[model samples]
Target: MRITLSDLNTKDLATLVQRTITTSDLGKYAVISNHPLLSELKKVYTEYDAVYTKSTYSGKGTDVASADRDRDVSFRALKNFLDGYRKMPSLSNYQFAEDLYQIFKLYDLSLDKMSYSSQTAQMKKLIEDLEKPENIQKLNALSLLPAFNEMKSKQDVFEQIFAEQAGANANLRNMKSASSIRKDLEKALRSYINFITVMKDVTGWELFYADINELVKAAKNSTVADHEKK
Candidate 1:
């Protein structure tokens, strides 16, 4: 069956892109025997293979690296691959895939690289905050009410940011801005926002906290009632 872009999920798309690139690289390597660039390509491909093998053995197989370190390394390898391919005269103008593949592949890799970088930075902040005794105590004592309230506020902010940025991007695309050659970016970002919003709603902070509070209260009440009867 022919797989269209709309048919593939995020993971599937990522895998498709990685496979396309890897296959292209291998084909070029085969054709360009005794090429000086072969050594570097082999080294990079070896690293990619190692990462792929490790993830498979761990039963957490993913095409795009999910972990921060591995993701960074994979992206670097991809970039190196692209750069080397550009330098090869023989591979020039070799059509690997259609424009959709070109656009989405670049978008996927670039967006993921940025997203992972941001997430890594955020994790560092969270770790720093958690390491502080006072902050840890404060977090430990967090009640359902305050926690949910804060989460709700943050959710609103996140939604607003997404909307504004999306609108601006759409406008830019419509205006045919120099940087707006990739029209699919706007669509991708919109879809991403929808996905994130649905996820947040499904895993709402308020609802989870309320459920935990109800469970704790029921346990406490059961204990007290048993003691009174005794």
Candidate 2:
């Protein structure tokens, strides 16, 4: 019944809130349906979702955050693929996986902690390292050349959009960040969960608690799976 909600990333947090709403409706839990907290949850969820969907760029430009996310995913997928591939002795190219994986270990792994510009610089250097002839040969042996190419593509796209909006971003007003909005939505969810925990013994409240608790568990499991996959 316990879920460490704060541990979830942006994507999974939205999924948790969304699935909770859907589950509450599916069971037709009047206790939840009538609650003021449910209304508040819906309101905050909408606000947070809209903020991210509509990029921070005031005019027509691609979202820098999304492109950054794609690059991050692509890199992690390559790293994780090597981690698994290197462990398989049966594969003739397993030696290549082990060699290329050493290249990744040479750099700092916490790309997300860096500022956006710093992250871009770091990715560019990493891509340069990966595209070296020695690394390219090993990557080809493991059939991972395309994965590196895709990561480079995402990095290139992010770099382009970021440069395009650099001047305009300075002029745009400071808007509420998606992270801040998410905190408000999470608070609404906590209030609803707290109320149900207190009232579950009441006539029709038990089922509502069960349904939402299950959704909470599911979200926790999903987050675990995502991390493991990476």
Candidate 3:
């Protein structure tokens, strides 16, 4: 079944996007063999690594030099990985899923310092703030986190696309039975995995490529199963 953005309810779409973004590895993108950002960051980090490596060699004996060189290599690798955090791709004018995915991934990383409860409270407050019409305008005009921001920024857009859009207070709902709803959900998930493959060639996110490939394989191989009742 073909699934467009309209096929998903805003809440479900938001949830899916949030879940995927949080789990993605943005630092891995910089290791993609051909990414421009990787090339750029490589030059910067190579110079940095050279300086640190030289420091390890100063007045060091042969045995110490050999061991220090090994340590230096490991240190440089860690630096390269961490550099990706500093060089996170900007989110402005992001038109592709890969781009948006990276943006959301980075934004989640920024919240790592917060406790779980604080993070949840902040997210809840953010959602409440976004529900206002004025707040929605602010979101669209400003550069916001991809999934979280776009959901609010495009709330009206979703409404226009989905003719039978579900909401907290939709009196004339497009009611579907439990089975049909489940089927639609399954189809939607399948579509998402298929979509990921289409955009999988994206660079600057190599760390996440393996995980995404695994997700695609799992999604494709998964079958719907009935649960036994006690």
Candidate 4:
């Protein structure tokens, strides 16, 4: 819960904020949702997201790297899940997993080892193969549709960010730097987190407080992991 928002680069910071507000069921309860600080957090995030979209160059390739890493993890999740599930011969899903694993095997993408460009290209084709009606049915049968959707979403986002990286002709003259907008967002985020920390013992706010706390802890651990890698 002690994440230093400033230490995270643009992509991670934006992702952290987005997940906090959007994924934490912030609007599920009117009582929690109507808080002044919650509204402020949303306002700040809207500006942050818009500014990040317009200020793509501010990431200095770090955003693309982050997107690529996300794609890698998601892709492997689908693959590794199928691989392991297929080994459980006694399970009802074993046959389904085996079928899905065969589809993955056909591609031989080896995404983790490929260069960024190469991996992206291969992933595009693999996703297309997955889209076949037969493959889709098998994935659904094995309860893997959500995982596949997540992997596809991450890939699509990575592709979009990758395209933005080479957009030198983009008109950035009037755009605020993502870093500057992020500072505003960081301020609002800290204020909101502080409020939640205090309100966590209250009845209605406990669920959101727990979810946001977990997100903050994950982000903090990820930052530490990133530092360790360096």
Candidate 5:
């Protein structure tokens, strides 16, 4: 029942070790080769396998507990080995970080759009249901008047955060130097102001104080703007 680290594939081994170490209370690995955390996990997994083998009476397959324990121990040991491999200095790569960030951002945007569409569909359904006189009366009596209002509030917050993050990313993309970065940041602020102006058509005075003119004034005070003007 004892599974050696060499028997498992590199990726599987790393994943198991990573999960175990992350869940366990352990300090950071000091020496890349002798990762104490991974070593401890492997030891635990080995002991687990030994206990399972003894309980199972040497592969006679006595019960489910023995089978489950053996499987769990093997998985954990393989995972620890893999985790140790990842902790090795040769495995660190910055491109992986960048790729992961882009992947997560795409996922976030997709989820946001899906949520908005779902809410819109739900509102449509509610309106349709309320068309019947009885349902309308019931809805009013049950105080469901605030359901759409709450949805609107939640959507507004989502939009605000999404827009702000998008604007920040756009500003970062446009940045060439420290001066250009400052200018782009100002431009981003103005873009937000323009967004509010457009929103005013729908929200009216609720967003009236958000003026693009004020952003223009703020941009005029920036050293980057002064340099560009010159």
Candidate 6:
């Protein structure tokens, strides 16, 4: 369901933050923890609930004038509302984004250890299988391969081809020599690098958020918007 951040309770908001932290790669986490925008977000998240409660429930201090009290109340509400915006990207696409992140991590962390080149025939079969409508449908349903650019989608397709090919190969059913493994690893690495190269414009949280935002926007402008129009 489409949701705005203000729609979530403290518990839900915290879950979103936790999901982001847990799913992120080290590079992504660095951005979340260190970037000025995201650092401020973490701070606001830590204190916003308490501040919202105080602003809404507590009376003005005795020394405050009535006019100033109203102004202060307005300002607090506005600030709290703005803070909620931080949760929007997560609320919209955390689950799919997590899946995509997992796929990337599988390649990033484990790619080098793979052994697919040894079973060229089986690897080709596996790639063909992945190209089937059913497998492609599954990925499409998750909205993992956004058309941010043609190159991004192409990278996704090729990476999946490499991964599935490796996994499906009978010869690679067991581990291989480290030197033998390097062949498949290098292949995977090349695909991964190509994918990241296509995405060179952004990195870390910025890149992560862009993926979700683009997918969400596409959905909203399509069926979601159409439903609203009707």
Q: lDDT: which candidate is best?
A: 4
Question: TM-scores, in order shown?
Answer: 0.18, 0.49, 0.22, 0.48, 0.21, 0.22
**Clashes in model 4: which pairs?**
none
Off by over 4 Å in 6: 1-3, 21-25, 28-33, 49-207, 210-230
Clashing pairs in 1: none
lDDT minimum window of 10 residues, candidate 2: 53-62
Off by over 4 Å in 5: 1-138, 177-230
Name the runs in model 2 displaced over 4 angstroms: 59-172
State the lDDT of candidate 5 residue by residue for 20-105, as single tens digits: 33432233322222435335445544433333223212222233234334433432332243334435545444333333223324
Q: What overall lDDT goes with each candidate model?
A: 0.38, 0.80, 0.39, 0.81, 0.38, 0.39
Clashes of 5: 7
Q: If both were scored by lDDT, which would come out higher, candidate 2 or candidate 4?
A: 4
Tell me the spans in candidate 3 whose CA falls farther than 4 Å from its real position: 1-175, 216-230
State the lDDT of candidate 1 residue by residue for 23-133, as single tens digits.
Answer: 424543333344333344344433333333232122222322334344345334433444444455565332221221243243343433465446444433433433366
Give the better candidate number (2 or 5) by TM-score.
Answer: 2
List the lowest-lDDT window of 10 residues for candidate 5.
52-61
Task: Give lDDT tens digits, candidate 4, residues 82-113.
Answer: 99999999988698898888878877738667
What number of clashing residue pairs does each candidate have, in the order they appear?
0, 0, 5, 0, 7, 0
209, model 5: CA deviation in Å? 55
Model 2: per-residue lDDT, tens digit, 1-230? 56677788888888888988787777477666646777788889998887756555566254877777888899889988988999998989898888877777665566755778888777788888988898899998888889888998988888888876776665443656777887887788888777778887899988878887888888888888988999
- Which pairs, if any, clash in model 6? none
Give me the candidate number with maximum TM-score. Answer: 2
Candidate 4: Cα lDDT at 182: 83
Q: Which residue ranges in model 1 land beyond 4 Å of their true spot? A: 1-66, 92-94, 97-105, 117-230
Candidate 4 weakest lDDT stretch, 10 residues: 166-175
